[model samples]
Target: MGLLLSSCVPTSGGLPPFVNPPASTPYGGEYANEILKLPVYPRSRTLDKREFGNGNSRVRFRVEGVNVRMIYNFFTDQIEDAGWGRNRLESEGQNRTWQGVYQRGIRLVRIRVQQEGNSDVYVLEVTFLQ
Candidate 1:
């Protein structure tokens, strides 16, 4: 059953293989102030975050029990409202995944939200452009 399979997925544990340990403070910390300005999904859990020496950074979060479209729209609206210009927006796999690129002055932000296969868990990655 769907409920049984969803329960087996670990929501909290080690970072995904592609992600490295946090090079600076995790979410809600004093590092990478620029990236932290963007809106974070309500009730999402911070999974991994890292800051680069070039003033760029990436943060990942996980959320569940929310419609994927709603999650996608939240970021798009909030990012635009924050004065970021939309460069591109695209969705594929029947809207199971969405990506958007926006810019404000010299800074760029790319947001991607993808459902974990058929599960309710959604992983969001936001990259702050230098």
Candidate 2:
């Protein structure tokens, strides 16, 4: 199932930063920022990606670590530190979702983090709305 899902994200030719990520990612490892076009959570792997006609981008990946809370916190800080607004459109742990929008007009970016059920790995989805 992991293989099937991961492979769904095709490595579009002529694209930079997204080298074919392993269908199955290691639980923990050092994944450099240059390798991932956008900033990624520590030890996360790219599983799927989509770019909309309007230049928006959505990248999906999985991450595994002892602290899901830490992962969520890191994202929050980074997004805001990166100039994203503090407006967290939605946040609900019971639903296991955290999302926010940043950079309004022409460079809008949205980020979301969600825990995938009982699995040790969670999904990190980011949309670059430009």
Q: Write down the worst ten-residue block by lDDT for model 1.
A: 62-71
Highest-scoring model, TM-score: 2
Q: Which parts of model 1 are misplaced by more than 4 Å? A: 1-95
Clash number by candidate, in order: 0, 0
What lDDT score belongs to each candidate, Candidate 1 first? Answer: 0.41, 0.41
What are the per-residue Cα lDDT tens digits for candidate 1 across 1-130?
A: 9999976665465554456666764655554564345444553332221211133332322222111122223322211212224433444554454456565345566556555444445556656655
- Compared with the true structure, the alpha-carbon lDDT of candidate 1 equals 0.41
- Model 2 per-residue lDDT tens digits across residues 20-72: 54465564344444234343355433222122113333232322211111122
User: What TM-score would each prediction reach against the true structure?
Assistant: 0.31, 0.32
